[model samples]
Target: MDPLAALRRPDDPACDVYLTGTVFLDIIFTGLDAAPVRGTESWARGMGSSPGGVANMAAALARLGLRTSLAAAFGDDMYGDYCRDSLERGEGIDLSMSHTVPGWHSPVTVSMAYEGERTMVSHGHVAPPRDPALEGDRECPPRARACVASLVPGEPQEWVATAAGRGSLVFAGVGWDDSGRWDLAALPELGHCEAFLPNAAEAMRYTRTECPLRAARALAERVPLAVVTLGADGAYVADGRTGETARVPAIAVEALDTTGAGDVFTAGFLTGTLAGWPLEDRLAFAGLTAALSVQEFGGSLSAPGWPEVGAWYEGVRQYTLSPEAAAAAGQDPEALRRYAFLDALLPRCGRPGPLRRAVPTIGFRRA
Candidate 1:
């Protein structure tokens, strides 16, 4: 069920969100008791492979019922073929704006997850330059209600500005600055964005503030909305336009792998924002989706769809009804109340069975 179905109009953009970035074939190893020791062979209890990187964000958005359009470069290799098929055919993401470069091979990442943390080793060559004429798309970006931009410090993406100019609400996220200079001024593209989401560390470094909330406030001055994600503590949000601020606690869950959790959080927030949900509700929803993502293996595959969201809502409600159940699970009744907004939203999400997700191997034939 499309969350925006009721809000859709005849003249609205066909795509709900536009994303562009590099996609990597992520091979994840899970259930490891410890990191690998020097010159030792380690056996993992579980493993899975899927499209990662920007594909994580794309899958999250699509699973949440958003009409996601991706503009990316794919290789002609088997790994590339699997990734392209997984996203377009399996996940229902639109790849019309994407292209495959001949002879170029897919980027690959092997991730090891242990103790709620992951270490990744990646290898890939830079993709060839995009030729819009050959790809059969306009030089300008396609119209969409929103777009997610991965902000690289000192390197402004021109497409962000172009999409924003064409009425796309731009939401930006940044990577860690390996240069040791966390200068906010280095990101010129922030001027074109409606919101900026950075993890607590990134936010603190960029604003030179000790507190994440303070950093969010400073960032709000630059963009209309600023969100600082505090991994365990939850998220802090500041709305520059309304002079509003919100802090939502993280949902407690036994995490199996933390990969792609941030992307899932962004997807949930984007959904709530587009639906005109209240500030606190948006934060709570984002935190919940992120919590769910970490419980499963792999990055893009772990993203939950509407069925998962609905099931979680029902489980929480049922558990909270019994004091014994809540106590047994260490569930805080107060934290459960934060997601009460789901009561109104879940009924609207018609019964969709379990969503198909990425598996440990991609060799099995699709039925």
Candidate 2:
């Protein structure tokens, strides 16, 4: 069956996992300093916008070959309308049960800060139900296989859950992207899902533990699996099954924009897992998707499709190794260096290098 056809099927093999999350219109500016332009230096580049947040994640998941759907809320503004149109017409993402509010502008994101390390300033779009923020009418799907519970600063996560209940696998992001503020109420409940994806810092914030290991452990106590993205350190995977822990290295790449890399990682990881790909391949797929995400601007305007991600991984010789594999292959020069580690491990640099390895459970610590 066409993966997306699942959107029409509410029963078994529901179209590529259903993603119910937030959808926002994103505005990105380039060549501008995050710092204020004080005196004579007027500016560098202007501004451009794209659909982001849960919208970006949904789009990323769609690129990875999922028959995707978004249950989100958007303002009834022109930009919100454009955002919904793109989700349906341009990307073919399903958008049923989305709410739309009038008067307020759809959510917008401004990408500021420096290269590698950047930040965004955003305004909320979650108004009362009166605002028309969703892709109305025929966009709603009968069901979805998975959902993305994204808690924007003021947005409530309860509403982001897939209406499919136990049938829908839930994935959530614990962050605000800009100020790092978020909803703690969703964390404990988030533990009930099949998996959880939160960046390293967000993980730290979630569990109130600066140590990623402790954070993962604390989170796992509530859920079965938690994928903690450690920026440059790679990612730590804590599995409730088999009681194993593993660290997967990031693909090496020179990154221009770090925007949307984590969301890209989650997209690839979920796509792979739903396809029944194993943990090892899933991690590599996550990294590969992130590498492709940075190559473009507007968050994910130029994300790589599934085949492209896999090809890129093999081209870079990006493959996970057993502890024995690492021991037998010896080492390369770049693998030994500190700054080189940053390229693969640092959030600023994009891809992460190998920090450690394991047999089955790749505990998401360090990386």
> In terms of TM-score, which candidate is strongest?
1
Q: Write down the worst ten-residue block by lDDT for model 1.
A: 131-140
Q: Give per-model TM-scores.
A: 0.97, 0.72
Off by over 4 Å in 1: 135-139, 351-353
Candidate 1, residues 1-367, lDDT tens digits: the string is 6888889999999899999999999999999999999999999998888899999999999999999999889999999999999899888999988999999999999999998789999999999887746755454478999999999999979989999999999999999999989998899999999889999999999999999999999999999999999999999999999999999988889998888999999999999998889998999999999999998887898999877888898888866688788889888877797888887777777534566565788668769
RMSD (CA, Å), each prediction: 1.4, 10.9
In terms of lDDT, the best-performing candidate is 1
Q: Rate the local accuracy (lDDT) of all candidates.
A: 0.90, 0.61
lDDT comparing candidate 1 with the true structure: 0.90
The local lDDT score (0 to 100) that residue 295 gets in candidate 2 is 60
Show the colliding residue pairs in model 1.
none
